[model samples]
Target: MPKALETLVAAGLMSSLIFPVYAQVKAPILPGTGQSVQYDTEGKPLTASESSLYTGQDASFEATPLRYQDNGDGTITDLNTGLMWQKSHDTTKRNLTDSIAVVEAMTLGGHDDWRLPTIKELYSLADFDGELMKPKSGKESKPYIDTDYFDFEYDRRRPFAGAFWSSTVYIKGDVQNFTQHGGLQGGFGFNFADGHIKSYETGKFFDGTTIQKSDNMFVPGNYVRAVRNTTTLYDMDYVDNKDGTVTDQSTGLMWSKSDSGKRMNWVEALEYAETATLAGHSDWRLPNAKELQSLVDYEKVDFPAIDTTFFEVTPSQFESQQDSYYFWTNTTQGDFKHTAVYVTFAQAWSKKNSDATEYFDWHGAGAQRSDPKSGSPSDYELASEMASDYISIDNWVRLVRDAK
Candidate 1:
């Protein structure tokens, strides 16, 4: 048994004899390496290890046993997370404020606990399937979601109908410019068409000088998919599989225990993930931004989002603020894929995140400066640059396998 398990056992809260079917332990053993496997360049799922060499495969992550339960009454329940969701997503035109009101007042499938999902919860639904939102190029990439289970529409048809609102409002004070009607502050959301997570100016008002008030809501082309049982959303844990692999029971993703060790550019990162093998499994691929962000422990803004006890925490050579070993994510910046998105697990926006007293675990503590990943990851003392262009952050790599 791993030391993480022993610690959990010592706490006297868990027992090996009693395994809860749906209860999420911190880390669970990863599945689908030996017997169940899929290959890249090949469309069909295969049985047995696809190849012996450390060749990269296509980024395919499918839920084993199909976790969706289509409850005849316009509702779907994800068995993995035990969260019930509205089956259909309506594109009815409404502002963010109205959208929230509509969902709050709604009673779907005879259940009344439906509410807007936090950015974290909303992002959980995102799956990095290229075909789901097939675009001429990534410029027109499909939505960052799985349309098979829900009535999602992320094709290239409607340019306006791209983003979906999350309950989490963007509080970072660094955004100099974006399309916010009400005010400068943006709201957190997932862009399906381009597969990026960002804060859209949720301002419903339009004024030349500035937004009149602060009602963070999407203007138009946004919809709501109500969710229930939020209390059960995060009963998850991380497990060191002891096989150079770590499994997240809550998300059902198998990740490489160690990181890529070095910082590489975006293109290099992908190539590294493709040709890597760990713990006798050759199916490892880079994790997307949504996947990377999910591991963050919101409560621990003072330290890395993850528990260093289980995950080998890589501290930065030149300390800045709360910065863990920055890892590369498959999710890219919306303007261009040249730059990719990465999670600053060691950070929290100080002005936004109200924690004080001095702990590097919480980022956002310092002023919103140019992220170190923007060209100078190792240079801790790089003077902050306020360029208009969006520079992609340089990142290390952590690979992931799909849910089996």
Candidate 2:
């Protein structure tokens, strides 16, 4: 019995009873969602947010909002616009070469992986044939999200749209290829300054000219829209045709040229287009909204109306103030009783609307302005200063000719 007891004690099974043993203590482990909380060798918990380990596939732990999408394709899609563009897109797209490079090198959202959108991806946001008057007032969905991407210091909504360039090559018939619109749509089927999905509409305007939707597709030149990208600075130069029509070099499209003092109403601008003559060229017509928008330079705020070269002076008699750097487009909104869309050079933005009555008089089957010397004036006024009598209210008018 003594030997057996000694054996049990040696085995330690009865050692606790034999020796005055203390209670054993164990640390408690908490249950969680399996996301590991980091710790040092001493077992102290780390303060970092609980996240999955960096798997090479989805290693974009530091990407910022509107910065990147971990597509797991070794490349990430730009969250700002859902474009998975290559680095080359930035280099070749337009004036955004430096901007893209800077973004690429940034350690944003905690990761250094960012790139411009490819043509296929970037143009995917176009709203071809969508309503121009209310271009971006649509519902949102998963595959399509119309969110503003440009956050430049000059203009908060620089990336929204005017016109942008895409990386895709537009191959027209007869080996005539063209650069894709920044919105990747044809004609003015280009994308909106604000990101939104668009539905198709008849490309034809009041006149018989074939206008293409501002999308990535090809059609006739019946209608034209405007666009600009961060990669380039678009300048507007005016051609002073002593005749009725004036040519806007920014779009290579002409509009009825008005003298700085001629206060012809909308009718006059149309008439100027109707009676224009340049180097034996007739067939001139007043530019529609998109055609007018094509000439706006968002970066340079001076002389926002049309191109400076086109005008001896900006028209101030129209609704928008000369300092406002915005003017009316020929296009009218669907049902806004007294409002019309206009472009502002202050930010290269095309999303502002002005009043109709104060800046213009729709008398004599056309439009007229306080400044009668300028050719034709669209009927509109600035939102803030409803005073139409200000002759110094600078504005611009452009003309267009049939593409034939």
Candidate 3:
């Protein structure tokens, strides 16, 4: 099946996966606070959602904290997400084919539990807040990863080589490299530059029966990082703090009791969250695009991608009031200054909703996408503009704080 037609189903790992799967392992922890806020066209805060700090959102810094412990015996452990990692890469620079074989055949520290990590698993190790950073010695530049946790070589020969191969051949039903901002053909990879995860192509072409490398053709390959499980990774596990907040058991992120309760522009949404003191927590902030999209449930297709039972989403009965299904994300539309990304909880992703007028690129109905940060209120023609208590708006805000 074409990758574009595929949606990530919440099922057991495919039998074809080369990595060894523990029943419920959440190995290869994700790094980065999930805040990639940048400047807008005028050099002002790009969107109200963006933070002045390079660390994106301050609350996220506490939520998805970069906590790790390096085991001298060639391994690293993430304290936030209990995932173990191989401290270094192959350094030999092999294509995707050899890379997989190298990890599978190896026995590290009298243990043979090592295997290539999935795209999601591989991403759990990135530290975006530290990208392009320089050490005290004044080196060229550094990737946004914590050198204390994982070992990565700054290959001068292959400058753009932070792209690491993931075990997932197909992601979200699209070939790893088939997304709007994707990589090669064989699988997906995590680009460490801005900490963006996209589809990466391997040099080989899968000819019905076999996977062959593009030896005749020049194949610029990515890195290989191995992962192993520490414990089970949960889904939809949340804890209501009685203080009007909900904490996710799996990701360790705490969310607001409800949304902004009204539609707002990008700036307004940011301010609303920044000033919010609900439940006695004043460190609330708008979630980035990826952070917000993480709430989606790919297994649910009828009403929306989010878990309606957990979140207060009243989709059918809002016609009489001023409300919008969209929420703003701090992610800029690629590098466009005027536009930013958003997600609609009320939309669904499917073949029937592929039409532009009916759906967005994500196929998941509104599929968190880009829209102008500031535009005419009628850009979406929302009814809120007509209400006396309403003002110009584009999206809503869903606040989150670091879970203590």
* Each prediction's whole-model lDDT (CA): 0.52, 0.32, 0.54
Relative to the true structure, candidate 3 reaches a TM of 0.56
Tens-place lDDT digits, model 1, residues 318-370: 24433335566644343332234566554332222222223232222111112
Task: State the lDDT at 281 in candidate 2.
Answer: 76
Candidate achieving the largest lDDT = 3
* Tens digit of per-residue lDDT, candidate 2, span 1-404: 69988897777855544443322213211111111222221223334333221110001112112243342322334433323333211212222233344555754333455544323234333321222233266743211122333221111233333333332221110111122321222211233333221211223222222334454343321111111122111234566667655655534555555432342343334344456565477654444433444454322323333345554444443323333333433332212212222333321211113443333211100111122222223433345422223333234334455333
Question: After best superposition, candidate 3 residue 235: deviation in angstroms?
Answer: 3.2
Backbone collisions counted per model: 22, 71, 17
Which wins on TM-score, candidate 1 or candidate 2? 1
Which ranges in model 1 have alpha carbons more than 4 Å from their true place? Answer: 1-54, 58-67, 92-97, 130-149, 153-161, 171-174, 177-184, 203-221, 231-233, 236-261, 266-285, 288-291, 298-326, 329-389, 399-404
- Say which candidate scores most in TM-score: 3
Against the true structure, what is each candidate's TM-score? Answer: 0.56, 0.32, 0.56
* Candidate 3 runs further than 4 Å off: 1-56, 59-65, 92-98, 132-139, 155-158, 169-171, 175-186, 202-220, 232-234, 238-247, 256-266, 275-283, 288-397, 402-404
**What lDDT does candidate 2 reach at residue 230?**
23
